[model samples]
Target chain A: MAVILITGGARSGKSRRAEMRTRAFPGQPVYVATAEALDTEMEARIAKHRARRGADWIEREVPLDLVGALVATDGGGARLVDCLTLWLSNLMHATRDWEREVTELAAALPRFKSPVVLVTNEVGLGIVPDNALARLYRDAAGTMNQTIADVADEVEFVVAGLPMKLK
Target chain B: MAVILITGGARSGKSRRAEMRTRAFPGQPVYVATAEALDTEMEARIAKHRARRGADWIEREVPLDLVGALVATDGGGARLVDCLTLWLSNLMHATRDWEREVTELAAALPRFKSPVVLVTNEVGLGIVPDNALARLYRDAAGTMNQTIADVADEVEFVVAGLPMKLK
Candidate 1:
C-alpha cells in the first residue's frame, strides 16, 4: 500500500490534489477530516470542501487519535487524511504529546493495509511570527511534515493548483 | 539568459540554492539584497548569509528599486536577487504599487543579458493569520509568487533544504 504525503500552502490546492490521488487507488475513497467545525469560519470551510468532494466519500471526522482511526479504516478503500496540521493543533489543544504522536503516526504509516493519502501544510515558509507560540507551532509543523514525507512512498508539494513531486 | 525563481519557507535554504545557481554562471556574481539591516535580528541573518556566500561577489542593497538595480547591473555575471518577497514588503511599506512592480520585474527579467536567480518565501501555506494585515500580506505574497513564477524560466519550490522543480 502506498503512503502519499501532499503538502502546500493555504489555498494552494493540496486538498484537491490529495482527493485526486486517493481516487486513483482502487476501492471507495475515505475522507478522514481532521478539522472540527469549532466556529463559523471552520464550518463554512468544511461545507465548501464537502461540496467540492461530493457525497460519495465515506467521511469520518477524527479530530485526534488519527492512528486509531486509520487502524479502524485500514481494510477499506484508500484513506485520505484531509490534513495533519489541524490534527496536530487538535492534539496540542487537547494537551496531547504532539511530537510523540507524530512519531507514532510515522511508525504506523508503513504497516497500513490500504493506501493512505495525507495532506499537510508547509507553515514555516513565511516570515517568523511575532509570538512564541506561533514559532513553536510552525517548527512542529515543519518537523512533522519532514517526518511523514520521509516515510511516505510518494510526496508532492502543491502550489498555485499545481503539484510538484518531491519524492 | 535564465531567470530562476527559488521559493520556499523561512530557513528553507532558498538563499543557498540561489547562490549555487548564480555561481554556475560565467562571470562575477552580483548579490542584489532586498534586505536593510533595520534590526539586530536582520543584521545577524544578513551577516550569516554573507558568511556563507563568501566575499568574492559584488553586493548591492536595493530594497525597493529591484528593476532599477537589475538594469544597472545588467551586463555582469548572474545577478542573484536574494529574495523578492522582502522586496515586495518594502514596496508595500513604501506605498508603491506591488502588482505593477511585479509585472514590471517579470517584463524586465526576460530582457536581462545576465542570468537572474531570485529567492522568495511561500507565506500563504500556513493557517490563516489572526490579523487582517497578515492576511493581506499573505494574499499579496501568493499573487506575487504566482505572477513571478508565470514568467520565470525556472521555478523551484524548496522544502527541508531540498529543491522541487515546479517548471
Candidate 2:
C-alpha cells in the first residue's frame, strides 16, 4: 500500500495530477470525494471534476468519516481522496474533533492494502485572514498537511499545473 | 544576471531562502523592502525579518516603483525584493495600474545588471475567500506570480521551510 500526498494552491491542478497518479495503479479507481455539493459554486466545480475524471471511478462521498470510508473500500483499486481540507471543514462544522479525525486518517493510511492518493490545499501561504475563524482554519490546514505529508511515502507540491516532488 | 522567483504560503520560510540566493552573488547584498510597518502586527513581522536578515546588507524601502528602484540599484550586488504581494497590494491601494506595473517589472528584470531574487505568496491554494476583495487580490496575485515566473531564470516553491525547484 502506498500513501501519496499531493498539495498545492487553489486551481493548481492538484486534483488532476492526483487523478493521473491514481489511475497509474492497477484495479478500478475509487474517487473519495470529501466535497459535498452544498451550493451552485460547489456543484459546478464537482461536475467539472467528474467530467474530467470520467464515470468509471467508484465514487464515494465521505465528507467526515474518511477513515471509515477508506477502510470499507479497501482491497480495491487506488483511492483518490479529492481533498482533505473540505473534510476538515466538514468535521469542524459538525463539531467533531478535527484534530482527532485527522490523526486517525494519518494513522490508518499506512495500514491500507490499496494505494491512496490524497489531495490537499496550501492555505496558509497567503495574507493572514482578518477573521479569527479563517486564521484558525488555515493554521489547522497547514498542520494537517504537514502531518499527512510526514506519513506519506511520497509528497508533491503543485504549482501552475506542474508537480514538484518534495519527497 | 539571474532573475529568481521564490514563492510559497505565509510563514513558509521564503525570505530565508531568498536571502541565501541573494548572498550567493558577489558584492554587498541589497534588501529591497516593499513592506511598510503601518501597524503593530506588521511592525513585529518586519522586526523579526530584519533580525534574521542582519544589518550588513544595504536596504531600500520602495513600496511602489519597483522597476525604477531596481534600475537605480543596477550595479549593486543581487537585489532581493523581499516580496511582490505587498507591492501588489500597495499598487492596488494607491489606484495604480498593477497589471502594467507587473508587466513593466517583468520586462525590466532581464535587463538588470544585478541578480534579482523575488519573494511572493501563493494565495489561491485554500478555499475560495468569502470576501470579493480577497478573491480579486488572490486572483491578481496568482496571475502576477505566473507572469513573473515565466520570465524568471529560476523558480522555487517553498513549503514548510523547504524549497522545491519549479524551474
Docking class of 1: acceptable
Which 10 consecutive residues of model 2 chain A have the lowest summed lDDT? A122-131
Per-residue accuracy of model 2 over A80-164 as CA lDDT, tens digit each: 9989999998998899999988899889999999999999998875566888998989999989999999899999987855688
Which regions of candidate 2 fall more than 4 Å away from where they truly are? B1-121, B125-128, B136-155, B158-164
What local lDDT score does residue B79 receive in model 1, on the 0 to 100 scale? 96
Each candidate's chain A: what TM-score?
0.99, 0.99
| DockQ category of candidate 2 | acceptable
Q: Report the lDDT tens digits of candidate 1 across residue range A1-167.
A: 89999998876778988999999999999999999998886898799999999999999999998999999999989999989999988998898999999999999999999999999998875667888888889998999999999999999988855688889
Please report the candidate that would top TM-score against the real structure: 2
TM-score of chain B of each: 0.98, 0.98
Q: Tens digits of per-residue lDDT for model 1 on B1-167? A: 89899988888888999999899999999999999999999999999999999999999999999999999999989999978889999999999999899999989999999999999988786656998787778877877887788788889878788998888
Candidate 2: interface RMSD equals 3.1
Q: For model 1, give the interface RMSD.
A: 3.0
Error of 2 at A50 (Å): 1.5
